[model samples]
Target: MRLRPPDRFGSLVTLRLLFCHGAVDFNVGVTTGGGGMTGFSTSDLALLLYQAAQDKNRWPVLVAALQETANPFDDDAIYRNPAARRELLDQLLPHISQALDMADRFESQAVSQNLLDRTLEMLPMGVALLDDELNIIMLNQQADRTLAEHEMLANHDGHFKINNREQHKLLHHYIERSLEDGSSHALMLSPGNPRSVSLLVCPADLVKDRDDNDPPAVTLFLSNPDFQSLIDEQTLTDLYRLSAAEAELTRDLIHGYDLRSIAQRRQVSELTVRTQLKSIFRKTETARQAELVSLVLSGLAPLRGRESVTAKVADDIGESTGLRYCKGAHGQRLCFAEYGDPQGVAVMFCHSVRGSRLEVPGGDSVLRDMHIRLIIPERPGYGDSEALDERTVDDLAEDMRCLADHLELPQFHLLGYSLGGFLALHCAARLGDRISRLGLVSSLAPPGKEAGKPLKGMMRLAVALADKAPGLAETVLDHMARTILKNPRRHLGSSVDRKLLAEPDHQERYLLALRESCRQGSMGFVQDLQAVARTPLPEPSSLALPVYLWHGEQDGQVPADQAIQLDRWLTNSELTLLPDGGHFFIYSRWPQILANFVAE
Candidate 1:
């Protein structure tokens, strides 16, 4: 049958009709009549048509009818007759092509919008998109919040306007740079603002590809400084413990500025500045500017030889190998090093419990050059010395005496550090007439039970644990070594002269000795603690020998106040405080300490 053509047909409608007709006639359903109907009912035909449309069969006539129909289901009048349906499809082909084109355009727009929204949401920093004229197109949540908090941008006359004067200037500069130079730029918020914000400006082309019609655009990212990143100003105030005005003065003092300059800067009277300085001096316990500077710079000072008591001692023994082993009180082999003239007046150097004879700098040289004998004997369980089974403070003193007698020396001078200092004091008290002089560096007398009960208990527990479980005891000792003596580098702080400590390989050698001493000195240290615990301190009047006590004012481990107390106890004793020095004050201010000791 010849069919009439329909108008307003498109390609999509043509494809739909072709698919529907092909499915019903061939693969979809059964035909009924002899004329090749296959017994399919009207409802069956309609279901077959729907499936055919979805399957997209190539049938030109039905496809044309689908293209022409505005609504295929509503075009029943023309579709009722087979010839009319065929004619209508031809006319509908153009309209069907137009409909397909519209569908595709709509889908592409939706996808583009979705992509833009997702990209904006994924950004970490606040972002605002603006047109060439600086009109806001869109902003993320972070950007909105930042602008509101800083009041940088405000809604004015139905448009967002830059409200902050400084921020506006910054924005203009940033935009100009981004456009003229094609570069990214950033600016920090003004200090006058309560909140910290950073503005980053970049060409929008940096984010998107450039198109002919796309105007010049800029993106601004606003960021606030994290509070967690800043140190608390209050902590500085508390560390110095100064009032507001005094704190300002202290800062000037640290800068080496004169009081008059500080007053002028603060627009205050010089008298006021002087008053603050005096208050600062009292609070810091400093008497002079040098002392104050020393206190601050002690950590920066370089390690040097022990303050020269006299001159560097010559190697009178004429032997490079000065170290030797001797029998201690308990018949244990004690490591010893001799310096200077053995027949000259002997000076015995004792180290702390976890210290070794190696800690003394220039011992052999000083001993030899000064024409004075030097005996540096390792304490029990220190260096190569054997550990003592039973020990007391008096026992150590007796051992010292025995060593002095063994060398055939009638009398000797004594010097000690930390625990060794206490032992030296004890020895001086016992051998008042035999000892010539005493030097104690960063040492403290044993605290009485009334004052040291807690410490005593802790020591006792350690001793017990070590005796019961040697493995656990070793672990505890390792922890102590790591936290304390192992890294003297950390303690050196600003006081350690890097150049000097780095020279002569002394710092490395000293640290090595420290570790070795800790590993081997545990047993002797316990014995020493026991000794101090049991030995009764003699009356101050009993000590007639000259005693020199030195301590570091900044010592955190041992309080310098202990030195003051000891000075009061011993009438003939002299106390010197090292400003800004720590427990290892001797290492920091060794020159002065040694000179004073020699002069005495």
Candidate 2:
């Protein structure tokens, strides 16, 4: 399965060699023309193929790369034009197939990994493999669901933790014991709480069949009765052809409710409950309640919890709660979700690096009260938006102009949150008259001597990495995004103001936003960080538009001085510094921020 390089691609091989040898920085906008035949550059195809060669999920990586390069616009283009996709496949698939075949010559490692992943995903209980340092090496789909839904456990920077101090120590001890003497241990957690769960840790034997790298030392199994029923009512109705009432009844039964209890909760008679249960049984072809529940749980229903990003959002966001896509200037698909009053004043929001269209700070009610029409666009490779081969703040600002034109927004207030500030800043300088005002919330500033001075922990490492190694920075940021998505409680815990997220409603909204941030992976975020790190910071004097800057004194991600510097630099700008605000200060101060926009 050897692939001969086409004679026209003779020079591309040298480019690939240089890229592989680190002699070239692909992140520095490396482009090699393909004789003007294809929309994609030879270098882009070569790089994607190289990535696919090493990626476990090579087919999807290759296919997605092709789709991205082929049409570049129209997210649905692949499905709409099979011939186009096939043409792409013909050009690149053979090379990737050969690479994969060479890699699998000794063993079908790729197939084995897929099988192992599928097996873990199908398990009803959460499964995680951790090393002695408590760093997670592997996490299954149920593990993410369990961690997201449960309060007893959390993951920070891929390290697993228990909320209870004693339990946390005990879990660590058990992991150490398993690693030291190959022992197995089990314990119950949060005994009286509805979120209570049990954990089992066992030593894992070294696998001779695995590659040279050593695997995690301990395998942890987590499960709870409450975690068992993650499937939504809509999924049940769709799968079993049950009516809405019957679907609700089935869900209640699956959640361990008896007929009498369900009837009382539903404000219906026991007879009605039994009748609905009977109909559910008939639809599901099950005779008894236990059997019916077992049938649903043992089958595909459990996997519905890991549905696509479009299906995961709440139903009540607005008329366009789901993702709506518009074609970018380059025909790229620009995705955004609209919230608040559609007829209200338009305020285009730029989400953080790891955020999506669902990254509303204070939710829809706040926007409605302020009479602000909030439009949160998912940057390329975030949420349902298309991915760009190369991205720049200037390119992104142009895309925003396309979106504004598509939405018929003659003028709108621009707001950037966290990493999104880079885009907002560029838009302010680039879009000129189209932007009424600029608002930055806990946003990033241009890299300077004091760039990483005000940050600590992950944020600091991320900034430093972006400066020294953009590729590695993207990988690290993407991993962090996954961790935050899998366990948003960890994200909340790490924030400065825990009290705001303490309220269950506020907490749920925050968690949902965090979850959607990485819905399509964190490529958008990683790229944004690179663009910001590489792009020249705009001179304060140049951005003559009325600028509003908000920063938290206790901010852990960005320096407060940067905001103050912007305040001094901009001629007509105002600055607000919260004594207790942090990186997420926008969530709490959004009302004040929106008021400023409305006042204008």
Candidate 3:
């Protein structure tokens, strides 16, 4: 019998009649009487059809159907009998499985390539795909822009070369070495240009690129150092702790402006400009003008929103209470109280170990007379300030720099009282040129076993607790604060006799300052105690600024010996030994301190 004509796809409907007749005949052991090959039986008959097609017998219909197995359903494989359809599907199963695997692999590669292209497009740095010959086989958007900006990475007729002959030769050597050893390497290239870039060459074997039979040998990654990518104002402020005026000068100097031009633009005298540059140099820790510019272009710090000490003084300070804030590193808050004239010459007041900003009353007439913008910074973990577990004298000095920068003061006078004297020296050493002059009032010296023996008994106890068990120190100070609040005269002790606390106003102010110091706990007091114990402070003799050491001859907290030693150490210094003053002399003698610092 003749089968129906094949469709264009060479497909056929299910031939159930053939399977019904043949399977039944084979299973039941039935055959035609002629005993010819009239009835089909077993898989032996299906195998013969496959062999006939492989041997190129005249079986076009069966061969074509095998070739179309991938699209069998789409080819409309119409069969008249269900038995014939099931038999044909079983015979074509092996060919259909192979076709499915081929399609899956094709789709996977297409998706992978698309994702790679998109990712490369979004990169901020330049990237180049290089071949064995060091020619750029591929590059991304940033790479193209970089090449256009700087002729260092030049392209000629679709090949890339470093413009500098020396750098070019170096690039060749590195690329060849990477391919030879199948390793990765990195190098920085200056190309004798204003800026530089880092070139990272990784072996092709390391990257995930399956489609490249002869993969590119090396990949070069480049950083973009465009001329217009200068550090912003806020970045400068946060990074170097520079004031608005200082940061502006830094920007001008970085862009190659001379002192005269900067003065012309800012409408100030050249002397003012020179002073501002010196302040910028001190803050950024660069000694030369060229170095300052280089750092701004290449090594500026990331902005962290660290405003200068003056930024929020007017806004955050309560007009009635004189309370303010200064932000520290890592989102820490520094509590300070502002007193005196807002626009007056800036003078910082660092409190004694047992005192807060209120050590001097907020609205004192003496401070206003000197026209001083009095800034009293609470040390870490003091007053309403947050506690820092890791604090160093140098770190505290850096915080003071941030405070000065915020206040927009390029130069200021510095005063450290008691333990604060140790920290005052720290800042003076770091920023000697910026300080007009330095003054220490009964400041504690680094402990010399014999010299430190005369320190107050109560202070010694506080130091022991802070050094051995800080948690306990906090508790003790808290209790002490409460006691002082209950009865100020009793807690006055030897630091200040009951005579000072006789008036209600004097008692009230003294108690208020104590409350601020101990309100947050004893962390600040303990940190100060621990800092004084730090050894090998920078030499007072080495400082560039003048230092004044004042001590009470009758003092017990810090004896007269400390001032004598400081006098011997400082190159530009004077030791003023008071005849009958005590450790608390600063509260009474600040007017004199302010007058001396304000004097030329």
Candidate 4:
């Protein structure tokens, strides 16, 4: 029999013939006869052939059909008639050829696109392609960083936007014109700044061998003067065999600093600076400063100095690296930080709302001296911890349970600060005898009419929104998180906290922690607010363990009255009021509080 083209009608007719013939032969159950095979039935072979035709990759199915009987194609004689076997092969070969051709095409396209994306990522300046609607069709890694760092340029939901209205209008007008005429345009944003933001927009059609159907209309180039790919000084010294001072001078020149300015900054004579510069030239094999800087930038310097602070267990923990994570229930990441001695008394500390594991203020020395192992867990959606949607205070308790089990602590002291107190109480109640003691520091009470009375400023507003309008609360918290991430020192903490962070070392530590807290963005904080608003917090009376309440007399976020209320509700509880301490009393009074936690 001759084969026909695999058109819809032809395929249907062929399928119908195979089905009918296979059914007739299968019903007869004949072996070594003219109508049927010896081992593999005709009906089974027909069904396999049908499936292979419908499938995308036909070779595997064809192979399986052949393997249905041992030596079906040879001595076993699964096919009693040569005509039948010959007919099936004629039908299957076309589809197998088509599938092979398609696979080749897909692999080629994927390889080409991957190469393009990687090449774009290597460029120092930000690059983006835009359609006529100003929607971002594609943006490279540098462009993503640029959008994050600059307040002016934004890529909102794939739409490119400029925050400043007048600048937006001007840039839009130019972009539209460029799209129409296939022209190029340039604009300077924040021109008054010493290092201004430069934007260059050109028509995409100018590029050679452009796609014909619905191609990108505009190409945008972004250059921020503040943006620099910093090469590590160690890397420089290792690569060029330069001394520490020579590496410093090389870095300065690469960043566009002149010899005289470097001399003034180093408090050395211009002659000494020139001598160092000559040495750098000799080491780098460069004739001039410009050549040296260009050579450095053109090499691996542009890709260096990028550091990631996210860490895991058993890794060498750096002083600046506070994010240590572990797998929690459902394999979600639960990040926390350890303070005090590694072998000290274990106290699982719950961080407050809008707080990270790094909020323990007095440094690790105080905890070490007090012999307390402070295990501060970033609640769901906070810091480096994975966000759990629709989470509750009870869910946070479960996370604590997972963390404790992960650390192999059968029983440990528990403490909570601010909103964390609610989570601590929940854990204490749920974990039963596992919790040795419970401590609340400037903690909030169960939800009530007067629950939010003591709250002020953004905190008060957030609670109100969480109660009445959760979506708005998330938006507000997201904005606040971005602001905090942008400038932690300016946006995080109160005036008093800022004063405490006045020392550069203190400021750096605080800022780094704050950044890590918002690293996963505002979802963690939003989850906290939603949990607070909806979940019924555990009452103080439910927990049988000894409760310790430490409240600031001037506490503003959660009132001192709440601590008094908690003290009265608990059957066995001790309450302490700090006359001078406020919401942040944990920082100053942590040593004493930690000592009390481990004490009998």
lDDT of all predictions: 0.58, 0.68, 0.63, 0.66
Candidate 2 residues lying further than 4 Å off, grouped into runs, are 1-232, 242-320, 447-464, 482-511, 537-542
Best-fitting candidate, scored by lDDT: 2
Between which residue pairs do clashes occur in model 2?
A: 73-331
Top model number, TM-score: 2
lDDT of 3 by residue, 478-511 (tens): 4455545666555453544455556555555565
Report the candidate with higher TM-score, 1 versus 2.
2
After superposing candidate 3 on the true structure, give the runs of residues whose Cα lies further than 4 Å from its correct spot: 1-321, 449-456, 492-496
**lDDT, residue 591, candidate 1:** 48
Candidate 1, 1-600: lDDT as tens digits: 111122223323433454344211111122323434222233443443343333223122232222233222322333234454454344434444544344346546656866866666544457777765567777876566556665555545424456777767667777877887878988776656656677778888655566878777788776644322222224335655768777556545655688788889999999988787787678768877667645543422111112212222222223355567778777777787776666666678787766775565544454555566667787777767776655566667777877887788787788888778878888788776778889898885655532122232233334433333333334334334544443445433344333334543445435544765765635556555555556676777667788898987875545677777777778688888878666755654554666577663
List the candidate numbers ranked by TM-score, top first.
2, 4, 3, 1
Clashes of 3: 12
Q: CA shift at 122, candidate 2, in angstroms?
A: 8.7
Residue-level lDDT tens digits of model 4 in 32-93: 54645454444555555454434424433433343333222233232355455445544544
How close is each model in CA RMSD to the real structure? 35.8, 14.2, 35.1, 20.7
Question: Model 4 shows how many backbone clashes?
Answer: 1
| Clash counts for all predictions | 51, 1, 12, 1
